[model samples]
Target: MRICIVAQTFAPQEEGGAEIVARMCARELARHHEVFVLSLGMSGDRLAPTGEATGEDGTRVVRVNWHNSYLPGHKKPLVGRIEKARWHLKASVGAVSAKEIREIFAREQVDLVYAHNSARMQPALFEASRQLNIPLCVHLHDYALLCPKSSMFSAGGNCDTPCLKCRVLTSRLKSDGEGMTAIAVSEALKQTYLRAGVLTKADWHVLRNENLREDKLHRPFVGRDSARSDIFTFGYLGALSEEKGIEDLIRAFVDMPNRRSAKLIIAGRGREDYVRHLQSIADGAPVTFMGFTPPEEVYGVADAVILPSRWREPQSLILIEAAAYGVPIIATNLGGTPEIVEDMKTGWCYDPSVAGSLAGVMEKALKIGHGNWWAERDKLFPGIRGFKGTAEASRYYERLNALLVEAQRPDHLHLQAL
Candidate 1:
């Protein structure tokens, strides 16, 4: 089957968690099925409007000219809800003709259209998928559909209480003006586009179980059995933006015991000023600015990890990777972080609401015995799929194939497997 994987951006164009997911999934899917990625072009990279590139040595990549909301050279494209909304508005918003995408689909002869957050969160791509008569599968990368910030985090920067007056929800209410009209419209969009209709009804909704079967590295994980030592390393991987709880983590680290020896490593890119501010807060307290190392190396250097996200992180790759490497984690117990890192098991969860919760957790982690570390590490086996290679991702392709077969032959019902 020929698969068209659509996303907001792609590898060698822009490097991020979402891009990495697309890259890994495309590579895995290509091994068993013909996989082609249709992605937005990054700034400064010159090429034709749409053309092919390779993911792995063998996998294919196709870049498309979709509008980037950020100005040509500006950083921090996705700073907040408004910026993201504007970005989404720019991408397919009044820019790319749906007729063009439809023509591409027709020419490419795609069997399935699997979009990540791009089509799932943005209304324009949703419209294009419909116009193209393509069976769409939108993987829920984050809470973009539910919350504009995609963190499900409101003002004050925390995710503890279930949000009711979310900006997106409240903004719609303000526009529609009271009564049943706004409520009705919101429900219709959720039902029609989000839940059971536009996003899922096209085919399958792929949600990954923690681990994959292909990588034999799954069991007997490397770097996990290492003993904790005096030069304690505390690190944060992934986006270092404000919503990611970087400030809070630093504040907690400031309050931590014996901070002179402990090393704080912050990886990944975000606001320059904010990152510099964090570095200053460190105040020469043994913090290293290892900006955005390769994934394998990031896991290699980590003694323990910190995922003190002030927002609702849909699923943290950092937490999963930390657990996989047997590096204990100290993350805010919000969103899917808890689902990945079991408190006091794989790692500890700090009170994201309070100031010292993260710092206290770090102190406790330092106290944990070496034997207990191995025991906690082994407990991650079931949730280890998140770090496994494309085998678990292949299940997504299988699910997509099943849904399409069922759609094409509703009456046949033989339960097709890909």
Candidate 2:
């Protein structure tokens, strides 16, 4: 069976969550079947040209030069109102895009299409899959099906429901989700889509995200000893966007009277303006901006890793890394954070909506100190360690294989298996 993973990007090019998961699935599926990736390239003109390239490690990547308003670069490329609207409209229904996908599918003779974070190609891909009668599987990494921003978040906080603009933009997405296989990375994400009435007629499954299964990736997580230093460094790993609550973390830490003893380390890249704004608002606080360093390095020195996301983030890979490194976790009790972090047991979860909530949690964490988070931390969160070998990826391959094997059988409805 030949499987094509359709995504916005692939490695060894970019390493976002979606790209990482897509590559992982490709690796696992390659063991049993032929696997490759199909992605949109930033190169080439707007004529939607296509090219093929093989990575040094022998990963096959097929890139289509399809631009939607603006090309997404190292940082999210900014788009204006008219162009943004044009892009969204095209995403909703692009006959040309559908034709292109159908031709690609025909040429490749792919048995299945696994799509992740390919928003710009949506609805068109759905039509293409239907026209070719090819099985399509969507791995949800965000609320792309419901919100045009793909982040059901705003300047305020996590949205209770999609805005009117989002409702209009994604009106047909739910119905387009029909006849496809849906993989929600978390139960929360599954429910979020269900509430939005998406994937009602699709084969739905929840596959919680997991870290890479490798020993080198799971190095001993050692919390700093209290005797070692008085300076408590709080590390914020991942995108440095405000919706991630980077500003809130800076504000909270800066306002604290005992701020002198604590330092804030933000490790990740963001838009230049946003990064400059965050730096400006830090107001001379003890915040170090380590641009796009390796996650392992950040997990090593940080006393406690904070996930101050202001949105209903599906999950945080940072949480997994922090746990693997024995660093304490502090995150807003929004979305799937609570599922990973036990309030008083493993890590701290707070409500960022309430004033001084994150600050209070930070104070408590600083007081508690990061000494033996647990005698055996792996037992504290098996989800972090359990899936740490080929276990997680193999599980994905098994389920997908089952789907491809018995998709026409009536018993295939029971695909909700773990």
Candidate 3:
């Protein structure tokens, strides 16, 4: 199988969860099959002088600049429906050019196109998948395919509201015409393309979950757990967006009765204004904004990991990463979170909607103490064999291969009509 993995960002550009997954998957696939990555470079960055290089794992990578011009100078507020509508419009146009993509498709002769977040960064890929008659595997990193905001979080930081607006509405209105619109259109186009039978004949919809690697279950914190007794640590790793509940995490930590010894370590960067706001909210609590550390390090130092996501996380890699390290999790009970953490088993879950839920959960988790956590770790953790990365990766490929076989079958046409 010759697979071309497509994503808006990739290694050497950004260290996002999606990028990490794509790189690992592509490299692993390359061991058995021919895998080439087709990724977009940052707008202003040209190819490095050395050009393409083989990854340590024998995977080939090719980076192309696909940043949209609308991305720059388009960042603004979405106050009303009309403004939100217009913002989605220009975003849809600039993410990727169909003409440029077609040329790449013709040249690559890709057997399968695995697209991550193409709804925004590469709409042209959807069109190209149709034009080239290539089997397209769409990976849903989040709810971006179904909701404009991608978090499935309602406006004004609420989540109870049912999904109403599609990215198409935003795209059609040309409200802001930025990365946001490109994002919405990706979802809108995904729904449209699926329902309209545009890519119904394609290979698969690859929705990635957290890195459920259970092999590292015994890998505990490097230092003596008892030695760090005086210090209490809470971990939150992900983009520091307003919708991510960074604000709430700050508030909860401040509200915590154990605020004296406890410290909050936030990793990842986004929205400087929001970060500043969170800092102000911190007041005098121990909050450290590390701004995106490696996944290993982020999980290494934490006594317990906190995923205070206000929005529904399709799945949280942080939760999976922490679990793999046997770190107790304290996350919002939303989206695919339940799929990962069994309440009071692997870790604790709290409602993001409630004010003191996070604070309460944290206080209780702190009481459990790290030394005593191992006895309950197995109860919380998934089966070691099932959760191993090798097993998980194999399942992903099996599903993907099955989709390809299904696409080539004659009965698919009848099913397509229905």
Candidate 4:
């Protein structure tokens, strides 16, 4: 199958988990099938015009320069905001990316197009697939369809319903997601959309994200050092945004009675103001702000990982990564996290909404100690075995592609007509 993977950002851009997953899936699919990537070349303040490049894995990548109304090159914050608003307005009518995607389909004879995170490129790509009579599979990495914020998180918790601003802003866009097959990273995400009356007619599937490379499966499990029994290391890895409940985590850590013996390590980048706020809250607490540490290093040092997200995390990839490293997790009981972390068996889940819920969980984890944590790790090892690589995930995509092809066959159409 000649599959064209579409995403707003790809490797070297590294905006979030969706881009990483897109790159990994493209590379894995390239090994057995003809694969191509179509991504925007705009990263941060850099904007590269439309061009062709080869992925590290030898997959062909077509980088289309999205000349949306958003003047990404502008340095002024107000100017950038205005341009972004203009671009969103224009995108709602039809994404400027449609023409480029149509050209790629014609040039490459793409059999199917798999799109992820339709932030900059939405209705346009969907329209292109429909016009070309090619199957388009959309992967819901976030709640962009229902809410423009993408995270569906604002004012400390998940939005109960699409707000007036969201409805008005996205009014022109046809997000009904018709004529596209849908795949969500977690069951919780799928249910969220279903409950919101989005993608009602689309066939949906739940495919979890892949975290660990296949080679790492055999790597020896490095349990927490027995010598370090004097102190427990608790870690938080991912964006340091307010929506991630980073403040709550820090508050919890500071309030713990074992604050001096227990250490908190926060690894990831976020807004400067937010980072400073977190630092202020951590004053006198045994917390280290290791900005943007690699996943390997984050997993290597921590005795346990915490994901204190206030929103329904589509799927906390960190949970899977932590499990792979034989580290137990302490996450909030929200979204798809519980699906990954089997409460008590794999890790503990606490309510982030409650004032001291996360702190209580942290205290419990420290009491359980490292020895028992490692034993629980052994029990949860099988659950995380699925995170080894993208082989199984690639197969799911291949099967979906084949079924789409079969559905489009002449005989199938004739049977439907009969």
Number of the top TM-score candidate? 2
C-alpha local distance difference test of each model: 0.56, 0.71, 0.58, 0.70
lDDT of 1 by residue, 53-145 (tens): 665456666655555544222134447878766664453234444565666677888766666645322454445555665555555566544
Candidate 3 per-residue C-alpha lDDT over 1-418 given as tens digits, one digit per residue, 9 for 90 to 100: 6767776555555455666666766765666666777765443453321125555666666655444432211133335866555556545555556676677767877777766654564456666766777655555565544455555566656544324455453242112111111111123333433543333433334334443333533455422123233476787888887677788888899998888767888888877787788889997878888986766566677777888777666566666566556566788887666555663255677887676988998887667655554444455443321343333544655544455434434343312210
Per-residue lDDT of 55 in model 1: 54
Model 4: number of backbone collisions: 0
| lDDT tens per residue, model 4, 275-307 | 998999999888999998777676776788899
Q: Model 2: how far is 300 from its true place, Å? A: 0.5
What TM-score, over all chains together, does every model reach? 0.73, 0.87, 0.73, 0.86
- Indicate the residue-level lDDT of 390 in model 3: 33
Which candidate gets the maximum lDDT versus the true structure? Answer: 2
Worst 10 residues of 1 by lDDT: 176-185
- Order of candidate numbers by TM-score, starting with the best: 2, 4, 1, 3
Off by more than 4 A, model 3: 41-67, 70-88, 121-123, 146-149, 158-165, 169-230, 369-371, 374-418
Number of colliding residue pairs in model 2: 2
